[model samples]
Target: MTILITGSTGLVGSRLLQRLLEAGYDCRAMVRGGRPKPAGAHAVEGDLFDTESLARAVEGVTAIIHLAAVFRTGDEALIWKSNFDGARNLMAAASAHAPHARFILASTSNVYDKSQARPGCESDAVAPTQAYPASKVAAERALCESGLTWTVVRFPFVYGDGDGHLEELPAHLLSANWHPAMRMSTIHHRDIATAMVLALDGKFDGHVVNIADDVPASMLDLIALSRGEMTASARPLAEPWAMQVDTALARSLGFRPTIRTVFHAAEQQLL
Candidate 1:
C-alpha cells in the first residue's frame, strides 16, 4: 500500500516514515524545499497551502497521514493559515483524488479542557484556548464533518530523543524553579508511529483515540527523574491542569507503553 505522509521531515513524521519504510510499505513524503527526503520514501516538494501540489501528492496514494502544520509560536494569522487552511487544502485534495483512502489526522490532547477528569475519553467536549490548540480543533472538525473516511489520534505530551518540544520543558522547569505534583500523560515517538500504522491496518475507523503511556507522573516526579530539583518557590500550574488520557481505546487496538520507559527515554534525551 502507498502511504503519503505530510510534514515528512518533522519529528513525528520523520519517525513514522522510518517505520513505514521498515515495514516495506511504499511511502511518499511531502517536504518543503531544501529539506532532504527519507532515503526509502518518494519525496514531493510542496507547501501545504499549494492546492495543485497537494493534489499531486495525494494522487494514487492508498492512505494519508496528515502531520504537517505550524506547531510553534508564530503570527496568529500565519498560524491559522498554515494549520487550519492548510488542513482544509489537504482535505480537499484528498477528497478529489483519494476519497476512499484512510486519512489519519495527528491531533493533540490540548483540545480537551486543561482540568479534565482522569482518563479523558474521546467523546469528551473539546475546550481549546491557545492559538495552536484552536487551529488543531478547527482542522479536526473539518475532517470529521467532511464526507471522507478519517481517523483522528489525539497525542498527550509525546516525547523522544531529538524532540524539539520536549527539549523546552527542561528550560521552563529550570527558569521557573517551580514544580507541582500534577499528574501528566506522555508517550514515546516509536509507540506513536507503531499505533499509527496499526490504526491504518486494523479495524479502527472514524474514531478519535487518545494515545498515552500506561502511567501518569507528577511534575515533581518528572523533575527528579530528569535528575533535577525543584526550587522552594517552585509551584504547579493553576487549576484546570492537563489531565491523563483514556488510552483504553488505544489499548483495545493493541498499543501500550510504560510510563517508566517513557520517562527514562525522555531523561536520556534531556540530560
Candidate 2:
C-alpha cells in the first residue's frame, strides 16, 4: 500500500514520515515550493492550493495522511486558506483520482469547546473562535460530508523525540495568559504513529478519535518541565476542562500509547 503524506517537513509530518519509512512502508511525500524531496520516499511535487498538483499527488496512493496545516501564526487568511480551502481541494482530488484511498486527517484537540465541562469527547460540539481550530473544524466537516473513507485524529499537546514543541509551551501559554492550574492532555510522537497505524488498519474508520496519553498535566508543571518560569497563581479556572480530552474511544478501538505520559518522556530523555 502506497501512502501519500503531506507536510512531510513539518513537526509531526516529518517525524511520522521517518518512522513509517524506517518500518519499510511504501511512501510518497507531497512536496511544494520546490522543496527537496525526502530520502527513501518518492516525492510528488505539488501544492495544496494547486488542484492539478493535488491530483498528481493523490493519483494512485492507497492512503493519504494529511498533516499539512497553518498554526501558530498571526495571519488569519493564510490559516483559513491552508487549513480549510486546501483540505477541501485535496479531498476533491482524492475523490476524483483516488476514490478508494483511506484519508486520514490530523486535527487538533484545540477544536474542542473552550468551556467544555468534561474531558473533550468525540461527541462534543466544538466552536473554536481561533482561526486555526475553527478552520480545522470546517475542514473536518467537509471531509466527513465528502464521499470518501476518512478518519480524523484529534491530537492533544504533541511532544517528544526532541520535537521542542513542549519546550516552547511556556512562552505560548504565558502570551495567551493560560491559568497556572489549567490542565491539558498530551501525546508522544511515537503514539501519533501508533494512532495513524491504527487508522490505516480501519480501526478508527468513519469516526473522530481523540488520541491522548493516560494523564493530563497542569500549565504550572509544564512550565517547570520546559524550564520556563511564570508567576504562580491559585485562582479558580473558568475553563478547567478546556484542553483535556477523553481517550476512552481510542482505547476501545485498540490504541495503547507506548509512552504513557509526558513524565515518561522526561524520564527517557525524549523531550
Candidate 3:
C-alpha cells in the first residue's frame, strides 16, 4: 500500500522512510523548505500552512504517518503553527482525501505532566506543561475529534544512530554534570518505525497506545551506561519523568520491542 510520511527528513521520519522503502512499500515523503527527498520515495514539496499543498500531498495515498511537528525550546508561535496548526491541516486533508486510510499520528509521552506517577497509561489525563507537549495534546484532540480512522502512538524519547539528542547528551552531562535523576523512557528509532508499520496492519484502530521499550532507566543509570562512570551525582528530579506504559495494549496486538537491542543501539551511537 502507498504510505505518505510527513517529516521524511527528520530523525524518526527519515529512518521510518528508509525502513518502509526497504520493505517494498510505495512511500511518499512530504517535506518543507525545498529539502531534497530521500531516493526511492516519491517526494512532495509543500508547507503545512498551505492547505492546498497538504491536500495534494495526501491525495491518492493509502496511509499517512504524520511525523512532522516543531520541537524547539522557545518560540511559542512557531511551535503552535508547526505542531498544532500543521497537524490540524494535515488531518483535515487526510479526512477529505484519504478518510478510510490508516492515519498514524506520532505523539509524545511528555503530554503527561511531571506530577504524573510512574507507568503512565493511555487513559491517563493529559497535562502538557511545555509548549511541545501542549501542541501534541492539541493535535491529538483535533485528530480524535475529526471522526477519522486514526491511531495515536504516544512515544517516549527515541534514540539511535544519527540521533541529535544522543550525540549531545554526553556534552550536556560533562559540562555541568547536571544529570538529574529523572527516570527516562526511551525506544530505538528502529523500534518506533517497526511499530508504526505493525500498527498499520494490526487490529487496533482509532485507539491510543504508548510505544516504548520494556526497560525504563533513570538519568543516573543512563549516565552510567553512556559514560562508564556511576559517580555523576545528579540526583533525580523531585518530579521524576518516569513512564511505565501499559504495553499490554500493544502486546495484545502482537507488538513488542527488545529493550536490550535498543540500548545497544544507543550505546553504539553514544560511545
Candidate 4:
C-alpha cells in the first residue's frame, strides 16, 4: 500500500518515514520546492497552501499520515493557517482524489484543559488556551467531519532517538515554572511508529486515540534522564495531572509500547 506522509522532513515525520521505509512500505513524502527528500522515500512536491500540490500529493495513496503542523511558533496566524487550514486543504484533496484512503492526523495532548477533573482522555471536553493546541483541535474536528476514514493520534511528549526534544525540555519547563513533581506522559520515537502502523492497519479506525507508553515520568526524573537539571522545589503544583493522559484506550486498541518508559529508552540507548 502507498502511504502519503506530510511534514516528512520534520522531527517526528522524518523519524517515522525511516521506520516505515525500513518496514518495507511504499512511502511517498510531501516535500516543498528544492528540499532534499530523505533516502528511500519517493518525493512529491507538495505545499500545504497549494491546492494543486495537495491534490497531486494525495492521488492514489492507500492512506495518509498527516504529521504536518506548527507548534513552536510565536506567530498565531501562521500556526492556525498551517495547522488548521493546511489540514483542511489536504482533506479536501483527499476527498476529491483519494476518497478511500485512510486519513491519520498527528495531534497533541495539549488539547486537554489544564483544569481537567481527571486524567485527559479522548472523550473529554477541550478548550486549549494556546493557539497550537486549539488549531490542532480544529484540524481534528475537520477530519472527523470530513466523511473520510480517519484516526487521530494525540501524542503526549515525544522524545528520544537523540532528536534533541528531551535535551530542550528542561529549559521550557523551567521557564514555565513547572513543578518537579508534576508527572508527564511521554512516548519514544520507536513507539510512535508502532502506533502508526496499527492505525494504518485499521486497529484505531474512526477514533481519536492517545499514543503513550506504559509509564509516566515526573519532571525531575525526566530532566535527569535528559542529563539536564531542574530547580528543586516542594511548592504546590496547581495541576499535577495536567499533562498526564489516559492510555487505557490505546492498550485496548492493540498498542503495546516497545519502549515502556524513559528509563527503558535510556537502557536501550535509544535516547
Clashes of each: 3, 0, 3, 0
How many clashes does the backbone of model 1 have?
Answer: 3
Model 2 alpha-carbon miss at residue 195, Å: 0.3
Writing each residue's lDDT as its tens digit, candidate 2 over 1-271 gives 8999999988999899999999888999998966988888898899988988898899989999999999879999999999999999999999999999999999999998878879999998888999999999999999999989999999999998888888898768746989989888999999999999999989999999999989998888888999998778877889989899999999999999999888888998888
What TM-score, to 2 decimals, does candidate 3 have? Answer: 0.89
Clash pairs, model 1 backbone: 114-240, 115-240, 178-234
lDDT by residue for model 1 over 110-191, one digit each (tens)? 7878667555788888867778889999998999998888888888887775665554566687564444666678877877
**What lDDT tens digits, residue by residue, belong to model 3 across residues 1-271?**
8899998998788888998899889999988766887889989887788888888989998888999888865898889888999898888888888888888899988887656676777888887777898999999889889878888998887777566665455556667444456666778877887688787785557788887777776666666555545454544456654544556787877678854544666556532
After superposing candidate 3, which stretches have Cα over 4 Å from the reference? 173-181, 228-237, 240-244, 259-262, 266-271
**Model 1: residues with Cα > 4 Å off, grouped in runs:** 174-178, 232-241, 258-260, 263-271
Candidate 2 vs candidate 4, TM-score winner: 4
Tens digit of per-residue lDDT, candidate 4, span 61-84: 999999988878799999999999
Q: What are the TM-scores, per candidate, against the unseen true structure? A: 0.88, 0.97, 0.89, 0.98
Best-matching candidate per TM-score? 4
Q: How does residue 57 of candidate 2 score in lDDT? A: 92
Report every candidate's CA lDDT.
0.78, 0.92, 0.78, 0.93
- List the candidate 4 regions with Cα displacement exceeding 4 Å: none
